[model samples]
Target chain A: MAIEKHDKENSGGGRPVAEKGEHIVARHLIEDDNIKEEKNLVIDGVDVSGRWNTFIISRVNSEFDRSFFEEIKKTVAGSRINRCWQCGMCTASCTVTPLYRRFNPRAFIYMMQLGNLKELKKYIDVAWRCVGCYKCSQRCPKQVNPAEMMEALALVIKKYFPEEVKTKLKLDEEVKKIYEDMIIGHGRLDLAKLHTYAIQKSGRTKELLGKIERDAIFKMVKDGRAFSVLRLGKPHNWSSSKEAMENYLRKLNTIENTEAGV
Target chain B: MAIEISNRLGLANVKSDYIHTAGRKLEDIHERLLELEAKGEVKVIHIKEENKPIEAETLLGWKKKIPTNKLWHHKSCGQCGNIPGYPVSLLWFMNQMGLEYVDERNQTSCTAWNYHGSGTSNPVGLAAVAVRNWHRAYELGLFPLFHCATTFGDYKEMRNLLVENKELRDEVRRIMHKIGRELVIPEYIVHYSEWVHVMRFEIAKLKKYDLSSIIATVHPACHTYKMIPEDCIYDKDIYAGKRTAVSTGVMLALGAQVADYSTWYDCCGFGFRHILTEREASRSFVMDRKIRPMVREAHSDVCITQDTGCTTTLDKNQWIGKAMGYTEQVPVMADVMFAALACGADVFKIVQLQWHTTDWRPLCEKIGIDWKKSEEEYNAYLEELKAGGKTVNLYEYPKS
Candidate 1:
């Protein structure tokens, strides 16, 4: 009422669009994504009308996420979840936290500790943002190891919503297939092929022809990097380790299958 | 426990006889190096922080030491696999300094990579491998110096676990025994960088090329400095702190302006297998937290790291920034390579400049390294490649 009165009193044939939230004073503070503004709105005999019919969603988290905490704590990486004491040291020391506002290690720990799954649900997209820098673990006063905790978060989120994670993550199967085959075939990362393949995949083919890159390629050829690659060659007699890894994978699959069954 | 058995034999216990002291933390503690040395089990050198720039001969204990003798070299898979120059650079500097060392091919990979990457490889197998490698080193009477920071970090953690925890110790011992190698703890566990830091002054004196113009930044491998902070050699730049103690000291000694970037302490986002399973996360880590800060904030020319994983991560990920239209590049190289470069090691033969993912040519320009000479030599290798001839390696050297 006050905004409408003020806009009418001040408007000397001025535009109404400039008066964005004529109904609300703190309109500029709310994000467009969260704010619901309907023009020419009328609901159930109520004059909800226009952009003034704005609804600012509450940002405050109301619930805790303990089940998610337990889920994380059970994982080998997050076994130390009990050690966090809500000190913001992990967040302060986090490498990712500065780059991203939502990647708060301390808040995540507190939310997980208190079972604030509702709040955590909102962060599912950014949950995998942690790069596993381990700085949080090194500097954490409580040794919470938020680095691996992020890994646990990634796993639990994957487990919680498998289909969502698969679609959201969208692993480049072709890239992974090439990567795995090289590792399995050579028992090493195969830097030359890996380098070329990664550059090619990123669509930076033209960059390869640059003077700096050409020189680096020449240097590698002259230097021992190329010789070592040639010298190390492929894995000899890799059957035993291959069999062992296969067995381990099979056993792991079975366990995961049984757990999912529950 | 040894004293209780000695009491029955009327054996004279030397431990209680003397109160020897060396200035260190827990100063004047009983059974110091004097008493410990008498036991013949281990030797301890009580070093103090105030005693800066101490002689290499004065250092003692396996936690951190300066070994000026023949040492067995355990090459890291990542070092050999990712940055080819890393091991050779360290070896070249050691040779330049006339410090004797040995490398072996029969030694199996530590398998720490497999364990940390996928969690499938067992610690028992790794512990046995460590002990077996130690036994081989012991046979040659040389201490094992690991090139891989993770290996050093992992072995240290494992050694502590194997010694303190009786169950794991017995398990590892059984595995080692089955393999016909007895479990004997190494006399000293030290990363290769520690030797570089200890010998920084000597390296500075012998510097043929000044690196003061080159803006080099250091990333202390998380494993070396943080994993087991107590066992890690240096704490701070001068004396102490867990952040990263050694790399900066060597960088400064080489006369390079050490750039203190915001994320100097941040991991390169290569958490063992973390990169393999989570490339986006790893890339985000290196670029967002590490690379962006270094390039945008610090304007670093070249980044130096002590660990192989870090070198690979930073050097390789710069291409990501390049691809994304952020053309500024930070050449990542091992600190040892920088030091070797200063000592006038053949850029191609000794430092192995070719293997790095990032073109260090630009950084080389700033550091008084002639790009043209290196280019000419590289063309020679291209000639070999063009002729389809066998490249010289482990065969051309003093030994494979």
Candidate 2:
């Protein structure tokens, strides 16, 4: 019987021996892609197939680039990056957090502080939804001014995650172009024109005047509210200011394009 | 439960420690501006008229002098473009009270909606625009009263930046010089709602409609108070001085049931850019955060706010809610417009409630306003206009 047991052990078979993958503790926790294996393999004249070659790509981050922090600190909105103590006050008071559980200002600031661009990359979609209410800034005990920091986050994302932003977010180019033209052309926003543009862009031009909207427009026209622009006209002395604004805008575009390597 | 208690206590301790270490209360921009004024570092346009003074407290128990007269109306583009009645209603109130103001044509829209919404303009551009507007007000010799909360907040931030950063001051000053204007910051950046708040009693005296049965919920515009929180007016009489007293103060003074709800601090979901780009988010946010709670929790008859965007969002987004089968919705309007309406201003001509998309007729009828009669009168007025008749003027300036 001892000889027979020895023979079984030498043959790589024993009474109730463990299977290849049974040795892996908490197998459910390891993702399928992460668990490396091969159906057949040889290394140094040895087969290391199946669970023998299993390995996990380490989820632990190994790099911290503090230069990103420095880049953010230079911005007017993010000048106070050093004041946050990770108290979660900003997140608690965040208007976006209630709507999007992922849009946590506290976490964003902490990640910014730690220069965790890898982790910050995950939040590109929801990061722009801050709404700029400043409730977080109001309630922040540290006075970190997380509202402005969120703006800083926007700049950083635009700079660092351009590809992701391009794919994930859609710029209302037509509306934005109209806004630019109006702000440059008249020195103020024409909501009437913008509303028309919005309706047209949304393909709701057919429904431009819903039953209620039609009545409202009729009332407005009758009351002369529809032609208010004709009455109020443009801001006084807007031409010179518009020239200066255009000059500044041109200079700004150049600087931004240069920074973006455009 | 024990963990939560410990965590809360720990947080409190940390906060107390932070405050102790900081060793000072947050500086009020007004105080800092006064110090700068003493040193001739900046120019401040003071409230120098025969103005009615109201005692309102800021967040840190600081007193704010809210001027109720001699105002320069800084009109909102959105208010002027979409809801013309917003400014007209406020102007009508000024006319009724015999207050002095300038509805100046030179006043620009502040362009903050563009800045906040599109992120097109930088801080320097914004600050330059702000100082230019302030200079215009100074040129007129009147106190600048913001008609829009977004402008008010944006100006507050611009003021902070100008006060702290000399380089920015130089840049803005250069831009101002380019426009042939000087750097002028207002002594007190007042909102029209704060004006309504201070004059609530006088408005109550002029109140023609009984709002006793009207249960109103106030959506404090986040831009009005949340931005530059230290400057906003809070009264102990209203919400124990915890909440802003602008809209709620007016409602309470006019004898309305000012109901409280869970999401009072949430944004109206105008969301600036979100309103333009992500319309669904804005619409859904207003519905879930504001409309639903006002309906379910507060049982409100109306949602009164103090900003143009808040009014528009709260009023217009109800259709989105209705499409989503949210059958309950409350009428939304500016506090001053509601006050004007309560003071028996012409609904179609002055308050111009007809411009609103929602069915505010039900709300008007609830407050004893005859919608049918008002419509008939409006139609008749239109006919008269068509027949080359002169329209009603809120203010009559004496010919020089």
Fnat (0 to 1) per candidate:
0.00, 0.00
Model 1: per-residue lDDT, tens digit, A85-130? Answer: 9879888887887888887878877767787765666677677777
Badly placed stretches (over 4 Å) of model 2 are A1-262, B1-23, B388-400
DockQ computed for model 2 against the true two-chain complex using alpha carbons: 0.01
Q: Distance from true position, residue B196, model 1, in Å?
A: 1.1
Worst 10 residues of 2 chain B by lDDT: B12-21
Off by over 4 Å in 1: A1-262, B1-63, B235-242, B322-327, B381-400
Q: What's the lDDT for candidate 1?
A: 0.65
Which digits, one per residue and each the tens of the lDDT, describe model 2 over residues B26-111? 87778788888888878888776466666677767777888887788899978987788899988888888888888878877788
- Distance from true location, Cα of A119 in model 2, Å: 21
- Candidate 2 per-residue lDDT over residues A15-59, each given as its tens digit: 554343344554566444334333344443454444444433334
Top TM-score hit: 2
Question: How many residue-pair clashes does candidate 1 contain?
Answer: 14
